[model samples]
Target: MKVFGICGYSGSGKTTLLEAMIALLTARGLKVSLIKHAHHGFDIDKPGKDSWRHREAGAGEIALITDKRWVLMHEARNEEPPQLVDILERLSPCDLVLLEGFKRAVHPKIEVHRPSLGKPPVWPEDCDIVAVASDQAIDCALPRLDLNDPEQVADFVLKHVGLK
Candidate 1:
């Protein structure tokens, strides 16, 4: 799949921007897949759910399939977290995969920056960041998109990534 990344520090509105973009992207008839990276431990199952119980009971992988959706949860156990490329291999083909993390990966990316975050931009140190979306103007060789304007940002992303 053609891949793009949306990355930024915590509270920098990465998820919000991505959510907005996803709606616009899908409305345009493009099938999109996403892979988000979480630094801390997280669980999707409820405490009393059978799936939770099965996982707690040391099931290696669990597939919870229903009419509307299917979820496959794999327990890493003592194994290292799967690499991005490895996970990508398992995904069915799509028009694009907009990854929310894996900032260090070689794929092209857009860096979301809000100056109020008091954090420096990642593009300076990472060449893979092809553009920046921010609340205020700044001097940079790469393109700067308005973070508050998801439609414009979506347009820029599509153009920058050479996607229709």
Candidate 2:
């Protein structure tokens, strides 16, 4: 599957852009899957959920299934975190995968940039960044796209990644 990623500082609107791209791509009949990389700790299962209970009972890996969707939760348990490729392989087949975070991975990516975030652009250090989605025009070697223009951004990504 074709894979592209979005990377930026916190509060740079990565999630919002991802959500918009997903909607636009899905509406165009393209099957799109998303893989999000989270720092700190995150929990999809709540305290009272069966999946949570299973994990609490020391289950290393739990697969929660329903008619429409399924979730696989694995406990790290002192093991090294899985690689980006390893995580990507587990996703269901789709025309393209939109990944958030994983900035260190060697995938083609668009950097979401906001001056208010008070962070430097990752593109200067990472040649893999092929585009920038920003709120304002910035002089850069890479293409600059509107952060709020999800449809156009999706088109650029699809063309750049050859998923079109």
Candidate 3:
């Protein structure tokens, strides 16, 4: 699958842009998958839940199955967080993969920026940033898109990734 990343500081609207792009991409009949990176410790299984109990009992992985969905949780234990490529290898094929995190990963990316956040764009520093979507004008030489218009950002992404 063609992979692209959406990266930005906290509350800079990365998720917002990604949501709109996902809707637009899906509407275009493109199958899209996403990989999001989280820095904090997280838990999908609740205390007293069956999966939680299994995990507490030393299961390395737990699969919770239901009519609507199935979730697999793998405990990393002493292992460090897996690399982006490792995670990508496990995903089923799709037309495109929209990555919401892994800012440090070297991949083609669209840097989402909200000038109101008072932060500089990631592009000039991160060469992998093929484009910038921002809430304000930037003097960047690379392609730039209005963050308010997701369709424009989506078009830029498709074109940058050669899917256009």
Candidate 4:
């Protein structure tokens, strides 16, 4: 499957852009999957849920199933978090995979930037960043895209990945 990444500092609207891009991409008939990296500890299961109880009972992996969807939760315990390649291998076939984090990975990425955030851009230091999407125009060597325009951003992404 083709892989692309959207990366930026916290509060830079990375998720918002991804949400819009996904809708646009899927509307065009491409199958898309996503893998997001969380910097802090996070839990998707509730304390009183069966999955949570199973995990609390020392189950290393819990697979929760319903008519609508299924989710597999694996506890890291003493093991380190899985790398990008390892996770990619587990995903089913798809036209594209949009990564929400994993900025250090070598995959091509668009650096979502917001000048109001007061954070330095990541493109200068990261060769993997092929373009910059910002709320306000800034001087940069790579192509600059309007952060608020999802259609234009999606077009850039599809063309960059050869999906257009």
Candidate 5:
């Protein structure tokens, strides 16, 4: 599967762009999957949930499945985050894989930037950045797209991965 990434600081609209792209790509009949990297601790299972209890009991991994969906939770136990390749291997095949975060990964990426967020663009420092999506246009070497226009961004990603 072809892989691409969206990286940005908090509140720069990375999740919004990903949500829009996923919807647009799926609507176009393309199989797409996503891998999101979270910096802070997060929990998908609640305290009373069986999976949560299993994890609390020190299970290394807990998988719960039902007719509608399935979830697998791995207890890190203070271990470092899994490598990008490791995460990719766990995912089923898809036409496209859009990653959110994983900024330090070497994958080709589009940096989502919101100037009002008070942070400079990461593109200046990260060579992995292939483009920038922002609320306002700036002097940039790479292609720039309006942050609110997901269709254009999705199109750019498709072409970047040679899918279209």
Candidate 6:
């Protein structure tokens, strides 16, 4: 699959942009999958849920299935978190994979930036950042995308990833 990433500091609208891009890409009949990296401890299962109970009972992995969907949850235990490439290999085939976060990964990424957030841009230090999407003008040599214009941003992304 063609892989791309959307990276930014906290509260910089990375999720918002990804939502828009997903809609646009899917509308074009492209099969897209996403892998999001979380910096904090998170859980999709509640304490009383069967999957949670199974995991608590020393089950290393659990697969929960319903008519609509299925999810596989694995415990990391003492092992280090899986690398990006390892996770990618586990995913089913797709035309594109949009990654949210994984700022330190060496994948091509678009840095979502907001000047009002008062956070420094990551592109200056991340050579994999191919473009910048910001609400306001910023000083940079990379291509600037209007954060409010999803179509424009999508165009740039498609072109950059050779999907256009």
Q: Per-residue lDDT of 1-78 in model 4, one digit per residue for the tens?
A: 999999999999999999999999999999999999999999999998888998999999999889999999999999
lDDT digits (tens) for residues 1-164 of candidate 3 = 89999998999888988999999999999999999998888898799988899999999989888999888899998988889999899999998999997888999998888888888777889989888888888888988889899999889889878899
Give the clash count for each candidate.
Answer: 0, 0, 0, 0, 0, 0
Q: Write the per-residue lDDT of candidate 6 for residues 42-129, one digit (tens) a residue.
A: 9999999888999999999999999999999989999999999999999999999999999999989999999898888899999999
**Candidate 1 ranges with C-alpha deviation above 4 Å:** none
lDDT by residue (tens digit), candidate 1, 28-84: 998889999998999899998999999999999999999999999999999999999
TM-score of each: 0.96, 0.95, 0.96, 0.98, 0.96, 0.98
Instruction: Tell me model 1's lDDT, rounded to 2 decimals.
Output: 0.91
Best by lDDT: 4
Where is model 1 poorest over a 10-residue stretch in terms of lDDT? 155-164
Q: Using alpha carbons, what is the TM-score of model 4? A: 0.98
lDDT of each: 0.91, 0.92, 0.89, 0.95, 0.93, 0.93
- Model 5, 1-164: lDDT tens digits are 99999999989999999999999999999999999999988888889877877788899999899999998888888898789999899999999999999999999999999988889889989999999999997888988998999999999999989999
Q: Candidate 5: which pairs clash?
A: none
Q: Model 3 Cα displacement at 72 (Å)? A: 1.0
Which residue pairs clash within candidate 2? none
Give the local distance difference test score of model 3. 0.89
In angstroms, how far off is 47's CA in candidate 4?
Answer: 1.2
